[model samples]
Target: MSGIYIHIPFCKQACHYCDFHFSTSLKKKDEMVLALAKEIELRKNEFENDVVETIYFGGGTPSILEISDIKLLIDTVYSNYKVVGNPEITIEANPDDLSPSLSFRRNLFEELKAIGVNRLSIGIQSFFEDDLQLMNRAHNADEAKRCLEFATQYFDNISIDLIYGMPNMSNEKWLQNIETALSFNVPHISSYALTVEPKTALKKLIQTGKIDEPKDEVAQEHFQVLVDKLSENGFIHYELSNFGKENYFSKNNSAYWLGKKYIGIGPSAHSFNGTSRSWNISNNSIYLKSIAENKLPSETEILSKNDRYNEYVMTGLRTIWGISLDKVEKEFGTDFLEYLLKQSEKFIADDLLYLDEKILKPTSKGKFLCDGIASDLFLLNLE
Candidate 1:
């Protein structure tokens, strides 16, 4: 019912489009790892709920850490928290982090498995050299392809990330990307349409005319291709960008979509309970110093009724479960819920939404524009 996310805010290199809080230098890796353990101990009982079903090691790149560091984290969690038996523990990895030869360094994967990391989310942004160059991702195309072959030998619950709608990426290339993922037999695949996030190097490049501006129309086309090809390959379009085969979906991510409470550790990580949201300072040095001083370094916000409604719309509309009219009415009053249902009517008529009993789910056609539609339905207090 509850989960924990620890952000390892360090990467070997910064990708152009990445805006996540990470230091390219590994100088603080040892100190940061220690700080994470200390923080975990400090906030051990923060989860009022006793059941912890998922633990996710996310961020800059968890795979960059030594096996001992990962083990130390797992030990800390098990010792300090009430981890459920057989909890889903995931580590985010990059292709370059994994060994190229399957037979070589076999102990690395075994050691990780022994330490209870039951899942791996590998960042294989693209399987093309040109795309890798554009993103400035550390791994080459071949490394991306080979790492999965090795991973499948040791891990079954594997999720690979891919980027679509790269400049000059045709429909044929997009299809090939999906086909490449299928060939790896990866149980879960997450594909995202590249966006020029604010303050990211990608945005700067575009502004400086070093890179072409991304086209929304091209992104939309690739997204459609992603959904269609994955569905045809027997992958369920569970979330907007996530496709999973059978029961291979990510438990941690699914919890977020379901509005479940979670505690996030480390800098720039966000935590949400049913009522309020909190986030840590994005600066690593500040976070470390604060935690070292036995201070919980985070800013807290209590959600207003309108804020809660907006969050519900944003998270719910992005998933397969969608927003529930009955739940909304119960939580946000009949008037607000009525207005939401009324707003959805036009979308439903336009084949962008579907009404199933008391539920309002987005159609496949609406998935790409989910955020925009959800924002449109947000309850803004004009008064």
Candidate 2:
């Protein structure tokens, strides 16, 4: 149930709201491709005892890569690690890269399928021209529709990303976005609220009054609609932001949520191995040089007992798989368990949390605030 995440650090253009690590220029694309494969081969021993059940190509824009580059990377994974019979291989792509108008792009889906890629996570933030412009997405309204029209014919387990809480989006328009996505009949969807992160173009725009700030009340309204609409249509609200049909849940994401060990390759990527976590250097030049010199360009830290407990609480509260009260008592002792129940008393009394068969979970009223609630129960600066 382990996975590997490969970060692609190049994008055609920058999205206004994005604070992720990426370069707009593809000047070093060829060199990057080789470094990534070499890093994959270099880190094989770390997972010698674990079989990789998923391989996720995430990042600046994986769809921009040549099909040969993709094949080589997947092949490197096979050559180095013990992979499952049918691993869930996914690529995060933008619609501009998947447009069927270009000759090479027309064959992209088929070639990806031939090379063992079984899933596609398309970065389709919205379906309206205005929303697309606000987010500065690479694809327009028409391209989003056209790509899905063709992509659905090629890949079955496709998951598209949609952003809610845009400043000027109307309630009717938000619902329209949902309905249009439903029209595609895809099995999974991952949606998120558009937050103005610091240092990004989005934050600056908001500060200068170039764009209106996204309202929290509006976000809450959209979230309720998203959950109800998706659930009514047979999509399970498994994880807070992700909805999936039966047997179609993302294996890579599920493994990570359940606290499984995973190796992350490429610059600005993070990795966890049950007891500790590590992250690679964010600078591309440093990562390339280190890999060439047979060194891992990364930093590592071991998790303390309280840190592990805090992490479990944060992740558990956000998923349908609630925190197991029995496991808490068993692993963290009566003292920790008592502290948990005491800290959760107010939420439970407010009907925001409840105990079901000894498992602690958030009620529908509290799901949207799980992160805040979990923080209240954190084991911070205490024994």
Candidate 3:
């Protein structure tokens, strides 16, 4: 089974730390929706042999769109694609957009369920007012709690995004954030450290000394707190940055980790088959113009053997799946497997990685260092 990702490229405000492509203006919303529908039709043939098992609506805040507009896009997919009988449909929303004041009029949560959206991934980065203002998030702390209260009443397949490691975030605040999330009894939580991406406001602030840089040690402490608390509460640390109760892992992201095929539609969306990958133009205006002219503004690349293997190691080491030596030997031949084993000896001896039969996985102490270890194990193309 395959998956589909729809990007909604509009937001009400720009978060200081976000580097994702999006426009804060809504002047072209209607036109962009039309262009998205056109793009879906244009790419349907790419997935002719696969039945869509998941439909994910991610973006510049998908909660900004009207329910009718969302339905239009879903209808386009249903009409053109071979989707399963009960595909998991998820929409990423922010707290302000789902607040009682805004949702009471339309009963947004119930409407979403009626229209086939089974899951909601709310962007509740923190449950503290200071952190919200510090990140310049569009919503306040009260709205965050209110939305979760409303959402849990209607949807059980819910996930919330949280952020840690802000310059001013203390351990107390970070622990409170986790406890606040638990208070809602959410089945899934996706949390990440505050990263300063180049060209983002956070980077500029740090460069000018307007804000302090995020401390790696502090972030590591926060991560440990997250893992311990969640594990004690019966949540599985299935992935480095994700925690879920039984049967509640994110199917869409899990498919990505497993290297399944998925078609991404809209500006800045990415698509991957087993052998190649492609991405749409990041500019909304250019994307709409191209779609209007019956053209796709995108670029594709065929993966090299080395590229595929490196990606496999990178993703595998970050999750419970680990790396399978047998699969490597079978798919990439003995030379590659031998090279991997030779390179892994030092880390294995240091207790950063462990070998269980034929599978290699990161030890608890090495989980935070998985990326670095994976890079060290990469094979430089000798050709």
Against the true structure, candidate 3 reaches a TM-score of 0.98
TM for every model, in the order presented, reads 0.97, 0.98, 0.98
Candidate 2 lDDT, tens digit per residue, 191-251? Answer: 9999888889999889999999999989989999999999999999989899999999999
Q: How many backbone clashes does candidate 3 have?
A: 0
User: What's the lDDT of the predicted structure labeled candidate 3?
Assistant: 0.92
- Residues 1-383, model 1: lDDT tens digits: 89999999999998999989999999999999999999989988787456789999999999999999998988998898888989999999998888656655477788889889999999999888988989999999999888887889899999999998787788999888888888988889998889889999999999999888878899999999888888888999888889999998889999998889899999999998889999999999999999889998999999899998888898889888889999998988988888898888888898988888888888888999888889889889921
Which lDDT values do the candidates have, in the order given?
Answer: 0.89, 0.92, 0.92
Model 1 worst lDDT run, 10 consecutive residues: 99-108
Per-residue CA lDDT of model 3 for 93-146, tens digit only, reads 999999957547248888898899999999999999988998999999999999
